[model samples]
Target: MKALDTWERVLLTLIALVYLAFGLGIEGFLSPYALADSTYNFSEKALIALAMALLVVAGEIDLSIAATMALCSLAMGFAMKAGASLPLMLLAALATGLLCGALNGWLVTRWKLPAIVVTIGTLSLYRGLAQVVLGDQAITGYPQTLSTWGNGSLGDLIGVPALIVPIEFAVLVVAGLAVGLLLHRTLHGRRLYAIGSNPIASRFSGIAVDRYRMGLFLFAGVMAALAAVLLTGRIGSTRPNLAMGWELDAVTIVILGGVAIEGGRGSILGTVLAAVLLGSFTFALGMLNVSGIVMSMIVGGLLIVSMVLPRWLRLLQRGARPALRTV
Candidate 1:
């Protein structure tokens, strides 16, 4: 797989220091149970981030993923209302996501439209459809098994109740690893990077750029649906607003991981670590009773800073190199 770079190393150190500070300063932050429970804050978001990372690496963006997730959750809710079994409900959710993604892919790839524009339109379209279906009502009373899967803990470790990892979080880890290997260890991944770097050049080099982009969109849609499954199970309810504004978080995680906004440069390891870092930061603020709006402001500030600081650093490096050469 891809090796870590200086930026990733700095992020890793920052994460370690932040965790240590919280563990030492907060009364219960170091407890095994508390540590495991905090994963709930970001595991679903991280799952989407993993897929979003690939899309971004290929020089594309999808603003519709959060809406796609909402629509998928509504599909599940309707399926349950119709007395569909869990397996069937799950299938319905996945199919809905795939269909939505295919629409996005077609609009962008086949119609030769801008991905940002196409996805933005679908973002509103999907969410509007969801609101129309539910219309100010929430669906509740999901299957007990689903709730258990979402909220239940693995058996205790070392006699610590619920100290083991959460099933949702474990799934995120497994997915992260799989994506990491795919992005870093496979030839398909190199094509994505090539396409991201320069689509016309990649095309000339025989890289089926459009096809890869479509596949990434398809993968992103499916991952968003999977996130909907986990989130619906955890909350035991569904609403049209489910996962509202989550696309921001997913993009933030990708950008904060040092993925170039223009694409063709980033690592899966960085995205994974960045997710944990952001998750921990958010959880710590929540523990302090921070307001949701303020927490969002913080996230926005972080995103802005993450984007600007790297450019400034590179500029400084360029300046220093000139000075050293003159010496």
Candidate 2:
């Protein structure tokens, strides 16, 4: 707990209060009606953001994650076309994601490429592969059980079954816990921060900075693959365009959660809160009949403000210290 700085604590508190107010005070915010229809969207987005937060903290980025997910979903669909069983299809999806992650890692670590550049290239490459696989078509008729897990909940209420706790939500919760541990509670987490703070110094201290970065990429890939599965379950189909332009959303959540863009700082809790806040805000805006364009602008503006506020405060403090010293 002492490890958390003042700003982090304050951000966490602020996000918590926002979520609480939105969840409890706002009408239709988490009502049974909205939960039945829109919980999956919030859950899926939250799950994806968890993995993304870790990637940003490690000083690496994976713009290809959404594409990786789409490719994996497409692979599963393609496998089913070839008469593959459910387990086989899942294995294929996981393998596709892992392979992409490894390739991205190899390019960045083994070849000394920047992660942003590598992932940006692979983002197109992977999505292009998905396009080739699906090509203006979608694969349907997945196993019934997969759909049930994807779209079904644990129990029913009156007539509705509580949106059936999305498999994506379960996966996201687990991933979030794992990442929070990795980033905040372990020696490896410390190493990651050290690497992010100063790669050359981390190397001198015997950390395999490149290897850690690669590991983070692979982890991000796996999480994205899981998100892909959840998405397939929710939609009950696979298409090349699935999860498109989602990288920005993931980045937005991380940044809004108060993660430092320069690296070496962030909180999974903050990310989770930011995810909820953004989801609720979007939903609220929609409920109020706000235009999608205006909603996007509001989100973009909020992100900019969140990022700038910390710096602005620091600048003010620096200016004030000179006057106080002179006095």
Candidate 3:
């Protein structure tokens, strides 16, 4: 408990420091509206990141999430073109997501295939399906309500620009809280940790490891679909390549949040903070006119650092223990 608390504090402090630096060093980063707008940069990705964190904690990875988002967005677009109502469109997106998730889960749990390999295969398959649906074209002219949900702010009610956050961002916050509670204060969470720590032992202990993994995959799919809705609303279009490479970003956020890639250790709070940190960093770079490729490089570098730093620190601590004993 004490160690987890300490790690959380460290993450919180790092977030604060990063924000402070960007606000002071970058032009327009301190502006109230700029900060609010930046939330849009990370909100959708963070939504999927939350689910990805859970899956990682259960000792699995899903590279298909971004592709799944594209597929869901394509489904929603098709439904809208068919004159479906807003609620119907949402249902279409959610259902599409659930089905995609179920497919991944089935392949892994039922077939007993490795999760990494299964998701990698599905990643290409889903994205290819999306391309087939859209076929070198884009879908536009979505309803106004969806646009409002994606891009609108609550400033109309709050009457304060600084306090006015995007509706999508607010939704992300609420979802984060719910997931945090589920992970830290629930029996299901304990089972996930157990499964990730040792699957054979977990099964011997009567844990339904395969069932729980399937559920996690399903959850991940649903969230990815939800993110697709928000993203399509914000952009008011669906393109086959939409959200391309976002899987890497989601994984980066999870790893940077201190979630063990091997599973069985992490927190939603840390994931949330890490999302904020990465979003803010990316936004700050954009303010400086950084290119997308440069941003990708930075993200890759951060991912490497995040993975290596903890292990390096642990080694130093281990070495210091022997010196202390000799003294």
lDDT of each candidate versus the true structure: 0.89, 0.79, 0.91
Which has the better lDDT: candidate 1, or candidate 3? 3
Give, for candidate 2, the lowest lDDT window spanning 10 residues: 154-163
| Model 2: residue 219 alpha-carbon error in angstroms | 0.8
Across residues 195-271, which tens digit of lDDT does each residue of candidate 2 receive?
Answer: 77888889999999888988888887787778787789778999889988788778888888878888888788888
Best model per lDDT? 3
Q: Quote the lDDT for 139 in model 1.
A: 97
* Cα TM-score per model: 0.93, 0.86, 0.94
The clash tally of candidate 3 reads 0
Each model's Cα RMSD: 3.0, 3.8, 2.5
Candidate order by decreasing lDDT: 3, 1, 2
Per-residue lDDT for 97-134 in model 3, tens only? 99999999999999999999999999999999999877
* Deviating ranges (above 4 Å) for candidate 3: 1-5, 156-163, 318-327
Candidate 2: which pairs clash? 152-164, 153-164
Candidate 3: worst-modelled 10 consecutive residues by lDDT: 1-10
Cα distance off (Å), candidate 3, residue 222: 0.6
